[model samples]
Target chain A: DAGITQSPRHKVTETGTPVTLRCHQTENHRYMYWYRQDPGHGLRLIHYSYGVKDTDKGEVSDGYSVSRSKTEDFLLTLESATSSQTSVYFCAISDFGSGGPYEQYFGPGTRLTVT
Target chain B: SQQGEEDPQALSIQEGENATMNCSYKTSINNLQWYRQNSGRGLVHLILIRSNEREKHSGRLRVTLDTSKKSSSLLITASRAADTASYFCATSGEQFYFGTGTSLTVIP
Candidate 1:
């Protein structure tokens, strides 16, 4: 346990509504990542932050925006939720970029349903 | 995306049997890792094999990395019913990219 937490472990929202998921960490690691997992699709990166206010788009990063205001908090906002966006979102933290890096520590994950 | 392709999308085997899954990547990787995800949960790191390491063992888990083949294999010996879950192999390059994954079913 890397002291990682994700808000609203489960949620259901209407289509076209905006949703924001939050990830908080206590380790103050330099690397934080957002990933979405769907059946048969495995885990796809949505966005990752190397440090506060520094973020990068991931492979499947279209329709999603992220902000890292502090080292402990990373926020992901979906401007308009769609049914196709229904999936489990995971947040991970690691000290991968500083120098010697290792495995990622994953949070509990958030299950979002767009109806 | 550089996502690895896992062979045998789904696998079913009896308990006490050995389960094997293969992952093939495109780019040169510093290390290859294996993660296990239980239903509706986040991923858990299992083991990692470095570029120079040919094989590594952690308990019943065996991981093999072949840079020449650009491929890797994960072998779970004497699998148990609790081992039934989705197994994914990820290679780290610019970042950690996951494979298609192998769904293993260990029947009792």
Candidate 2:
């Protein structure tokens, strides 16, 4: 789990409801990422943060937003959950100087089901 | 837009045998990384090979990267049942992209 924690390990929510996933890391890594894994799609990056208050969209950023107000915490928000968004979410951390580029340490995933 | 795609969606091999998986990317990358995930768990970092390096080894795992071909291969020697998992390759450039994965089943 790499000193990283994701809250609400499992959740069941209705479609159209808002949902938020939290990723907290004690490693204080400069880079944080949110990814979703599905049966056939593998893992898709939803968003990433390079530093506090600095964030960027990944390939699958639609319907999701992210915020990094503190160095140790990165939040992913689903403005309105949808059945298509139901999947296992994972959070990962990495520091460019600490290791090499993209030597990520991942947290246990959160299983979300939207009905 | 996944940047990397892993070959052999599923693999089954007996213990003590060897297993190999390959990943091909669409664009140039600074480095390529491999990760393994047990069922119902998050992925764990396995090995990383830089663009400048051609081969890397860690224990029973061997990774080779060919920058010219924009591809990489992960080979596990003397496989064990405990090595059964899904392996994914990720490419890093201006952004990171991950392939679907190859499910490896090491039979005892």
Number of the top-ranking candidate, with lDDT as the measure: 2
Which 10 consecutive residues of model 1 chain A have the lowest summed lDDT?
A94-103
Give the RMSD in angstroms, all C-alphas superposed, for model 1: 1.5
Q: Candidate 1 - CAPRI tier?
A: medium
lDDT of 2 by residue, A1-115 (tens): 6799999899999999999999999997999999999888888899999999999999899999999999999999999999999999999998784334868899998999999
Per-residue error for B15 in candidate 2, Å, reads 0.5
Per-residue lDDT of model 1, residues A1-115, tens digit only: 6799999899999999999999999997988999999877888999999899999999999999999999999999999999999999999987763333578889999999999
User: Candidate 1 — which residues are off by over 4 angstroms?
Assistant: A97-100
For all candidates, what are the clash counts?
0, 0
